[model samples]
Structure formats: C-alpha cells, structure tokens
Target: MLLKSIRYSLDELIYLLNQLSDKGYSKSCESLGNETIGEHTRHIIEMFQCLENSYDLGILNYGNRERNDQIETEIEFAKQCVVEIRTGLKSENKILYLEHVIGGLAIRIQSSYYRELLYNLENCIHHQTLIKVAVLKFQNIAVIENSGIADSTSEYRN
Candidate 1:
C-alpha cells in the first residue's frame, strides 16, 4: 500500500513538474512564500542528495542540514534530484532505515527506503497547492474545468 502511494505521489509530482515548467517567474509577489514550487523542488532535491550522501557514508543517524533559505530554480534542480534519487535507490543499502529527530518531532523512518521518494512527491504536492493558489491570486487567473477562458461569461469562476 505504501509503495502504491509512493508511486502515485511520484506521478503527481511529475505532473506538477510539467505544470511548473511552463510557468514564468513573472508572477509577482510581495514576498516569496516559504514553499514555492521552485523552492519545494529544490528542497526535494536537497533532501534526496542528503539521503544519498548518508547512504554513501554509511551514516545511519543523520541530521537536517538546511543551509539555504530556498532554491529558486525548479527545472534544473528537479533533474539533479531525480538522478540522485534513482542512483540511491539502485544502490544496495539494507540499513537505509534509521530513527532521527527533526523539527523536534520523532518520526518513524521506514526501512523500505522508499519513503524518501514518496516524501519527495508528497512535499511537491504540498508546495504545488500553494503555488496554484498563489498563481490564482497573483495573476487573478480564473480556473475553469471544461470550459476555459472561452466561457468568459462567468465571474472568474468565483
């Protein structure tokens, strides 16, 4: 079940990648949000890279080492992260599971080692929602399901 969820999330993340690829940085905002699509993608990359480094170092216990405010480029960052994630998954690491405290929370780290991949996807979704909302607000763009702007008879779809 978890694996399925992971795959689904991964697919969703891929879809988000497509959505974000065509988005321009012209979207104006007073301040960059904590988790924009680009930042979220970068965070996933960073998280995967950290996991890969820990796997390589055989370090069972690890810590969060966030050294930057946020990553602004999503496409290139996602590409790098996807490569690292694939490499890490292909490697033979039985002890990929470990318990560590993060944000003062003791979360159970699963051994299947697939959680990282899924988390990446889930995190992307978490940020994409924010991005979508921001896009709506920033551009004042209306979202219509079947009939798009062609049906301009609606009041911005509320």
Candidate 2:
C-alpha cells in the first residue's frame, strides 16, 4: 500500500516533468523564495537515493547525500532518477539505523526501512506542492492533477 502511494506520487512528478523544457524545469520560482524546480526535484530524488544506498549498509545517513547539480539542471537525468527510485524500492521491511550528525557527533537511532520510506514519501509531497506552485507560474504548462496532495487529505476530500 505504501509503495503504491509512493509510485503514484512519482508518476505524477514524471508527468509534470514531461510537460516542461529544460529551461522551465530549472527556472527559479519566485514563490519558492527563488529556488528552482530542479533543485526541489534533486532534493527529493537524493533523499530516496540516500535511503536506497544506505539500505544495504544498514545505516542511513542523509547528511552524506550527494548534491548532484546535473540532477537539478538536466530534466532527462532528473526523470531517470525518479524512474530509478520507482524501480529500486523494495517491499521487504527491515531494521535500520538512522544516523544523525549533530555538533560533530553521530547519533544513531533505531528505525525501519518502511518508516524511512514513508518520510521520503511525505518529503516528495511537500516538495511537489512547491513545484506545483512554480509550474503554475508558467502559463504554458497545464495543471497537474494531484501532483502535490497528501493521500490522507485526498481521501478525506473524497
């Protein structure tokens, strides 16, 4: 059920990307405090990439996530990243350690893969909401349905 929700969100993002040019994808949004859509896209993808990379290691460290500029500037690469995440997610839940670095110290907390995935799902929704606002500014792009809404909220509306 969680995977389905994540995939649905990812599909919505991809559909939105399909409607944009590289310039439009990377253009900074005034509403987002001048942050570009590509930046938000990269941040969302990198969080999932961090989770996927850390799964085998049994330790999750989002602080060590890669900030790839290409993922922000290149729409096709960004789309490829979303596709990779969509395909790479597994259904098997497992015990994991979330590593947080604070004041030069590493704090390890017990967590599950599913929990982290849920966090990533919410992260995607929040960023997509901002992305939706930015995309809306472009008069050329059509509205993307449910591109940024939360599942529970959507259910409530229905």
Candidate 3:
C-alpha cells in the first residue's frame, strides 16, 4: 500500500512534466525568486532518491542529497529518475534510523522504510504545488489535475 502511494505521487509529477515544453520546464518565476519549475521537480526527485539510497545503510540523512543539475534541466532524465525510484520502492520495507541535526546537535531516531516513503510522497506533493503555480505564471499551460492536493483533501470535495 505504501509503495503504491509513492508510485502514484511520482506518476503525478511525471504526468505534469510530460505536459510541459522545454520552455515551461526551464522558465524562471519572479514570484519564486526566479526559481524554475525544473528546480522544484529536481528537488522532489532527489529527496526520494536520497531516501532510497540510504534505505539499507541503517541511517537516513535527507540533508545529504545530490542536487543534480542534469535532472533539473533534462525533463527526460527526471522521468527516468522517477522510474528508478518507483522500481526501488518495490522492495520489502524494513526498520531504519533517521539522522537529523538540531541546533548543532545530531540526533538519530528509529523509523521504517515505509514511513520514509510516506514522507517522500507528501514532500513531492508540496513541491508539485509550487511547480504548478510557477508553470501557470510562466505560461498559459494547464496544470495537472489535483497535482499537489492530498488525497484526503480531494475526498471531501466529492
């Protein structure tokens, strides 16, 4: 169930990316300090990749992400990365630890792979919201239907 949810979130992003042209993907928005939609998409993909890479290491540190520029500017590359992440999530979930730093102090807490997947899904949705807004402002492109809204929020509309 968790993996399915993660895949759905990733698919939502891919669908949105597919609808954009190179200009829409790379265009910077003044409202967001000139940050492009590609940047936001890259950030979302990297967060999921970071968690996947650390799944077996017993310690997950989200701060240590590779912000690959290629993934940001290359729409096809970002789609491939999302596919890789979705494939990686097919494995069985396991207990893991999350490492965080608070006020110069490092803290490690117990967590599970499934929980981290949920976190990534939610994070992607939040980033998608920003991307959707930027895309709309940069061009008259139609945003993805329910791209960033949580499922629970949409359920109430019905």
RMSD, candidate 3, Å: 1.7
CA-only RMSD, every prediction: 8.7, 0.9, 1.7
Indicate which candidate wins on TM-score: 2
- Please give, for residues 21-116, the per-residue lDDT of candidate 2 as tens digits: 999888878999999999999999999999999998899999999999999999999999999999999899999999999999999999999999
- The TM-score of predicted model 1 comes to 0.49
Which residues of candidate 3, in runs, are more than 4 Å off? 138-140
Q: Model 3 reaches what TM-score against the true structure?
A: 0.90
Worst ten in a row by lDDT for model 2 = 138-147
What does candidate 1's lDDT look like per residue over 35-149, in tens digits?
4556655555566566656664444343564534334554645655555555445334345665587898866555534555445445645554555555554443443232111
Per-model CA lDDT versus the true structure: 0.49, 0.93, 0.84
What order do candidates take by lDDT, descending? Answer: 2, 3, 1
- lDDT comparing candidate 1 with the true structure: 0.49
Please give, for residues 18-95, the per-residue lDDT of candidate 3 as tens digits: 887777677777866899888998999898888988976879998889989988888998899999988877468789
Report RMSD for candidate 2: 0.9
